[model samples]
Target: MLRPAFLAMLLAGISPHVLAQPATETVPLLREIKNWVTGCDNLRNCHALSSPSGVDEEDYSSLTLHIFHQAGPEGYLRLRFDHRGEDLDLSTLLLDGQPLGQALTRDLHVELDDEGGDPEMHFYSVIEDAPARRWLQRLRNGQRLQLPGDDNAKVSLSGLSASLLLMDAVQGRVDNVTALARPGKAAASEVPARQPTPVLRKFPTAPALTAQEQAGLAAAAIKALTNTDTEMKPDAEAGALSADQAMMVVRTDCAAYNCEYEISSRERKPPYTETLLSIQPLPLDGAAFEGSVGYDETTGTLSYFYKLRGIGDCGAGGVWVFDGKAFQLREFKMMPRCTGSPYGDWPALWTTLPAP
Candidate 1:
């Protein structure tokens, strides 16, 4: 015969083997997913998350880098950098938690290669896993990571990328970092704790727009950044305009966007022309069009180019607009940035932004 208390204790000891199977499988699978650079850029705005690349930060020497887990396709990773830009399109630009749409900035380029198999298992199981393991023991908690790691990463802006991430996002902004995991989850270490990043919250104190126009612009910009489409009711253009109209005005008015517009028809101060063509997407298909608009503040004429027929690495000179709202095809011209280079912003434009 045995004491009842002793028998109960003996039975409890035998339960140890009951819960050890899943933990064995969970650890190894996460360790083999591997790491790869889905995209790499050493240029400014590499990730295109509204943070201007090539542009230095508000005179600060420290640079920020962001690494995203999945990009282009599922199971891949992408790393990019952002610095800054100016008078930005609201539909696409974002920095940290705010919007710095029109600040001149730089874009940083990055490069990467990976030897497959998760580096995560190496980091978590061997090092960081111990602390969480210690914490997990007290509560007898076996969380399954019921939640997924994800962010929307999209907004309605057309002028800039909606969101961005970097591999080096650690040093600059890591306070918002938080992570949740399960017992023996090997990938737990790579799951960075949520960090508070700096972004433009207060819109710049620029010249003001009317309430109606401002609200309309804000909404349209948000829509564009988020990629939402509107049905376009007739008065939709009256009380508030669509993203297309707001963006068109910006292109027509901006120097860079209008770079080709001034070159389309005639010669401005030379080295610039009204016949300037733009750098279109690869293959020169009309699917994603690229053109320019010109505004000569002195002349107050705003116009855009509708007919550009060439594709090459060339920069066009300035254009003289006869109209305040439309560009005349006759004024078409071109100013070559360089010879034999791809038709695009200077490769340097692919670099980081100057200090804001």
Candidate 2:
């Protein structure tokens, strides 16, 4: 039988089935997040708690956990632990609790960013990340990073990882530090499997407009969006739907924090065309990656894809077109880092593009 101490090792003692307060509004500091985290010795937030997530409190602190979900900064579903007599391990993110190495490594260098706060506060900004790789380079544009510190020009840099937190009103003499970490959001994004996508029952794609072929226009857009932290490429080639064949359709729309598109496009020469369906406003809170479709379309379906800020052309490759109405594991790939590739990392499952 699991003892209380055993349970405390996974979660912080909260019920995994219970939802903790999210960090949406500025949370009143029962304790500074940084301080509280670096000093968490109790299992209240460490282990034994159970929520609908089945994640124990102790699981939350096991820096080695590969499964971590955050409901934005407001809410988090993670498996981590505080540094108490143990070295903080944050090398990579925990993916389903399995540690991934160079094979899936996206970050190779943890370069420091710009200076953080005013000297009066003696605070500094540093990014706990790898050097500017292709994706990191694109994400770095106009972005700012800083260390969490107190208003008084002071910082106690001990017992902290590469995360953001508030430090004390004093400064530390440390410059750089390293720790062994395990391998590694917002709104709930549900990824659809190879099943048939949902059709509006009545809402088919809008008809194609424009008389001339627009390959040149798509080419132009591709040129313009390169490396600008905009535009995306599909991660992999989706199960192909012939040009305007049957009902294979692709379309998209978005809100802040995310730009989504419902895909159903086909293979055509010159410019590829896709139909535009439901365009939701950007940044639906609590919205993560989502994909689900249940229509009577014999064997065709649509995929839910997103365009994230700072992550241009850096995401999942394509959706898997599974057999037997059940979407199975289609292989996963990353989008090319160049321009003119399938925009965004995930590809449009529907091959039929909207008529321009």
Candidate 3:
């Protein structure tokens, strides 16, 4: 007779198989679903926002809705509304021109939190899961989501359902009771497990350089840059990386509008032995063609920001940390459409957790 443990294993092999989580490495993704844009991070956290393209410039009265959903059984769904104009009549918000009534306005727990200190008081509110779900149910059949007392501030509901469905798919919640778009009797345990955030080990910053040494290093890097392009000037920044290593950021082109910058690493003293550094995800096509790059001496971090327009409502940005010997990307985010969303609220295309 088989041992008890061996018998249990043999019996378990005959039982029905359960859904398993994906084993492949996860990458960040961004998708445009009609009037909405949704993105997911490496950890499977997803964000959905109203399309910035739908609002015209100078439309301050327009309200924006942002949704966030995390992965796993303990994940939560959060909804926030941002309004930058006059005090809104929350009761007047309508679905297909019918009032949403006082119930939702109260459930939203609306509050004016001008955390950014913009000139105008921006209305910020967070809706609880139950109420947010009810709102979604009501929105499913509506064509327009209209703001109270503002005819010009209406959001198209065309793509919201598709966006939520995409979010559910990304988090492996489809057919599970926790699904946002379509809830089924499938157990939540069947949903895929949340991916772990990557950790980065950052190196301590190098010793500070004297003013004279900084100027010399900056000049050497500038000479290397100017050798490639005659029009380059003294607009360059330099910082120490180690006892004998240094980094230099030079402005390559900025005749008009947005500026262009390039980064290079080299030896601290004469001969320089400079090598140009290439940034990943490349820069967006318009606005600043090559984008802007900079270094922070205190943190030993290099950063880049690319704007699609002068207003900076949309674009991409990234951060890299020096690991003593080389730079490693720590985070990256992008907002492809020029929606008037805050730069810090952009969707993450890449992310890494810091070492504890």
Best model per lDDT = 3
Prediction 3 global C-alpha lDDT: 0.68
lDDT of 1 by residue, 11-124 (tens): 221111112122121100100000111121221111221222122212111112223332111122332322222212222324334333322112212222244532221100
Q: Write the per-residue lDDT of candidate 2 for residues 216-283, one digit (tens) a residue.
A: 33343344332444345522122322223222321132245344332333323344444332222111
Off by over 4 Å in 1: 1-37, 42-265, 268-274, 277-349, 354-356
Which sequence of candidate numbers ranks them by lDDT, best first? 3, 2, 1
Task: Tell me the lDDT of candidate 2.
Answer: 0.24
Q: Which residue pairs come into collision in candidate 3?
A: 52-339
Q: In order, what lDDT does every prediction score?
A: 0.23, 0.24, 0.68
Clashes of 3: 1
Q: State the lDDT of candidate 3 residue by residue for 46-164, as single tens digits.
A: 88887734443332326777788888876888877666577676667887878887776676756655465655445555556777777777777788777866765666777788778
Name the TM-score of candidate 2: 0.21
